[model samples]
Target chain A: MSETPLLAVHDLVKHFPLGGGVLSKARAWVRAVDGVSFNVKRGESFGLVGESGCGKTTLGRLILQLIDPTGGSLEFEGQDYTKLSRADMRFMRQRMQIIFQDPYSSLDPRMKVDSIITEPLRATRRVSRAKRREVAVELLERVGLQAVDLDKYPHEFSGGQRQRIGIARALCVRPELIVADEPVSALDVSIQAQIINMMEDLKEDFNLSYIFISHDLSVVEHICDRIAVMYLGAIFELAPTESFSVAPRHPYTRSLLMAVPQPDPHARAKPLSLEGDVPSPIDPPPGCTFHPRCQHTFERCRKERPALVEVTPNHYVACWLHQKGGGKGEPLCE
Target chain B: MEKLLEIDNLSVQFHTPEGVARAVDGVGFDLHRGEILGLVGESGCGKTVTALSILRLISSPPGRIRADRILFEGRNLLDLDAEDLRQIRGQEISMIFQEPLTSLNPVLPIGRQVAEPLMVHRGVTKREAYEEAALWLDHVKIPAARERLNDYPHQLSGGMRQRVMIAMAVVCRPKLLIADEPTTALDVTIQSQILYLILKLKEELGMSVLLITHNLGVVAQMASRVAIMYAGEVVEEAGVMDIFDRPFHPYTQGLLKAMPRLGDRVGRRAGRLNGIAGTVPPLTKVMPGCKFADRCPHMFTLCKEKPPGLFALSDGQHARCWLKDYPERRKAHV
Candidate 1:
């Protein structure tokens, strides 16, 4: 079960500099992914969840090496893949694919399904034309698409069908880890279930590990083995899905859980616990990024940033309320 | 309770190059004073069209709107003259869209845009309108509302921009508020805040709301009654509790089952999600039967032969299905 973990991320940091000219110095940096660390295990689905601008997407991109990190290391298969050179990383990328949120824009409108699926194989593997066609048809059929659909353009298919094509393309590379960034958020409820079910089945058939990034906690709770709740570009809580749903330690995590309205009409009768919008990333809060909106915030929360620490066996939280000296899961910190 | 808004047999069609696409067909609903009526559907299901049709917002060349009557406060909106409709559009009825950025006047300062309605409708002076706008912004809980008046729409975050949109839409204190997926664009935590804000404002102003969205959870949280739409028709209309606890229509049941509920531990890996097979029937063709017939698990010969009428069930629930028409067919529904 513990074969060096599928992917290990350590203290990752990516700060995008705001607009500046050659004459003027960079005024400030938007801390997109700041000092985040996590691990994805073999054949496991890891979820990254947060609000918009919390940098869940940025973290996904960094982990996939679509973008470079400003600091820290990314270890894949027990090797420091972050240090890999351009060509080496290109080869490494063949093993880690990404499925985008918007199926409309992700696929080239002009390109047919055949080309879209086979393009990755052509770029990486030395496969014959006949072999590529065979693989394309086989993968298309596997993803519940008819072989006839291989010749159709992206626009011909509906949102769910387009997503299937996107999946086929990701599987075309035969990657071990797939980064699905809000893959089903764009689809309807019925279609969302279809795609999520298919992905679950694919995970089993292909022996794949997934880094599922979404703001939807329900989907995350359903699909992920473990989850990391990000707020303002940092993980405030990391726990196994079971532990996460039952005993969420972070104040922000509790607020997020409370905010998600259930389908039952009886649910969510109370007022919203969290207050205010996420502060600007350009200059996030001075102490805990979530302190301003957090209900349990106190003196320590306003002044000192909390690090992710294991208060329970598996549940890790970044809040003074759960700290050792502050007393475990008790009253608000002094 | 008195009915604030009554829509009867409302239909919207688009004259595309290929054929006439009926986006909404025979949609009817009632919104009582100070009540929230949720209109929920997937993409292309015409929930948005129904909301827009109330204000006659559809442009006539490619789009055409038709209805038996759209009564708001005892006046038929369909019979109103252009000038009369204009007077009633933002004053008697107001609407906020999914994308607030495009809806907002990007070039104008937030204060001026928010105050524009006050000057036009209430005939307040510029200074007076601006002061009132600031107060409205504060009502929506925008931080530093007075100081942020000088800022443009681009300056605010997504949540902030949505708040600005809300401030502008309800600043005149309209009798009816049509929010088409108001919180769909915002994050989870912010979504609850916005929903809470909408609820608060509705209570304070004694306004009826027509909330349109694809999310059942949000509908369950906000709406007192819900109307499920599919293929341009209202498939099911019931109290929120009835819709959640016992959905009569097959489509409504499918939507509820398909949604991944928070804290539902039923997700063991590769676990099948009860997704409704087949996609939403395209509006390109006018089929002569139940739109959901192809996807319904309990499909019968009658379902394909004739479109079912809305059968009035006990406890104020109505469902458009052959299953509801015959007790024998209904036995298969459960």
Candidate 2:
């Protein structure tokens, strides 16, 4: 809605060094987030979806600056966050928060709900101790938890309730952008809906944006306005939610959509003809990272890398099939 | 079709420091020969407990399992001695767990693990068992199965490890297979592959399967019939199509509506997702009424007064709801 996006990441790259010791030097780098670019508009829910080793989680961490990026620019609210000082970054973090996937490990088991919720406020010293407690109670209520639950420990609560605490903690800072990294994946189906609905309500109430990272397409489709389909480390496709679901251009996206098992038993189970598992990110295949498993592979696809190009108004795809003269033969999808 | 397994009035309780938790409360189901019966429910819904109870896997002192009958192929498994149960477990009935890594032996070679069941049950030589194991691994679509056989559990990827687990489970050619969230830990693509593999194996081997999962989509795809569980009770049981097309129980309806479908993104923008209002009731507390009453959207006075029995809807369809008794009231509410 606004001219400047809430969060803008340009060519972000994070490479984890593999096999570093006295005997062996860093042999190689696992390109966790290699040259990824995206922008999250204010009040928008942007989804990052991929398989296990696609580095979607790593990308989320990189955005939050939980881990340092190997290279790229991170601008939040038009300010270059990568260039910000330590104190400035810490202050900036108040505007950006994260909700983890696993509620069991995310929350401090020993700490009370009130202390956990108010930890962010305590770190910044932005409010009085009494005020912080009040904030925690209010935040707890906001997340559909009772004030009485403040005294209870993490172990006392269920998975869904613990996730609510995590949400309450994230909202304690009143962040403009929240990186929810597979927030509902660990939750049961029924509980997952509750959390997703709660998140939607909270987003509306706080006018917050989210970088929703998940492998579940259905959840991503429900919560996200726009989605980016990530591969080994790079985004293969980016499109609006409706367009992506209705007419996905990339073979990977199409395959993913087909792969999701529908809740209707009458619906036919389409055989997923996608060959082999996701290739190792450490030793990624040449050309398109998805080419090895992709059904529409050609001579050109095996030889050159494809750049992300806008095929339609808002739909972007990185595939040789879309580019003119890129495919050796006839393109698979029109 | 012949009934391969029949569970009648099965109950499992765990005595913890807090209280006696009724993990599985009078749950019953029938698995016909060569048919896949999906036990569908969320976490703590006792789906896994029901699966474990079938094999007498629940540890005693803390856990106590009671059943009128647990007839597997005309033999009451509950009446079987330790030695008889041991003989039946891997040979007649086998189970594959959610986490393949932990379920598998970390130190032992994958080949040995897969072959162990055959060697123990069939009294086959180690060399013959290993050869058969390689064939089963190849059947599950594990590439270069012979070479991967020597690798430890840690050596293979998550998807590969799950494939190995599947191979081991099917190597014995058991009469019944209990897959408790077999593909839960794998990615969507790999999950599709595994599900198809299981389907193929079921067809080829003609073995009855009790598929336990929290995912409704998986049930729709894999099972011929479905049993929807809530608070340790099977609230609804019907043919897969019947359950999906016209879910009778409020809990079943809630679970269905709660799922985020790919094409159902319209309501996401204009309206909030249709999620169940409250969290699952704690198993420690014993209530006289329906377990789902606390979270049921259509709760009436009768729902709290007494627990409902299974009301037969059709030949095979059944739902536990008071609304079925008072048809006029149910119609009026609708």
Give all candidates' CA lDDT scores: 0.89, 0.90
- Per-residue CA lDDT of candidate 2, range A271-293, in tens? 79976788888989988888898
Q: iRMS values in order, in angstroms?
A: 1.8, 1.7
lDDT of 1 by residue, A1-334 (tens): 4569889999999999888778887788999999998888889899999988999999999988888899999999889998888889889988899999999999999999999999989988799989999999999999899999988999999999999999999999899999999999999989999999999999989999999999999999889989999998999999999888877878888889988887878865587778778888999988898888877677887888889988777778888888867633563422
**Highest lDDT, which number?**
2
Q: Report the Cα lDDT for residue B77, model 2.
A: 95
TM-score of chain A of 2: 0.97
Q: Taking the tens digit of each residue's C-alpha lDDT, what string does model 1 give over B1-334? A: 8998888999899999879999998989888998899999999999998888889999997899889998988999999999899898788889898988889988999999899988988998999999999999998988889999999999888888998999899999999999999988888888888898899999999888999999988898889999999999999999999999988898998898898887876335424678889998779887888999999888888888898998899877999998876757655534
Poorest 10 consecutive residues by lDDT, candidate 2 chain A: A325-334
Docking band of candidate 2: medium
Which parts of model 2 have CA positions greater than 4 angstroms off? A21-24, A329-333, B266-270, B331-334
Give the CA lDDT, 0 to 100, for residue B283 in model 1: 91
Q: For every candidate, how close is chain A to the native chain A in TM-score?
A: 0.96, 0.97
What TM-score does candidate 1 reach?
0.96
DockQ of each: 0.70, 0.70
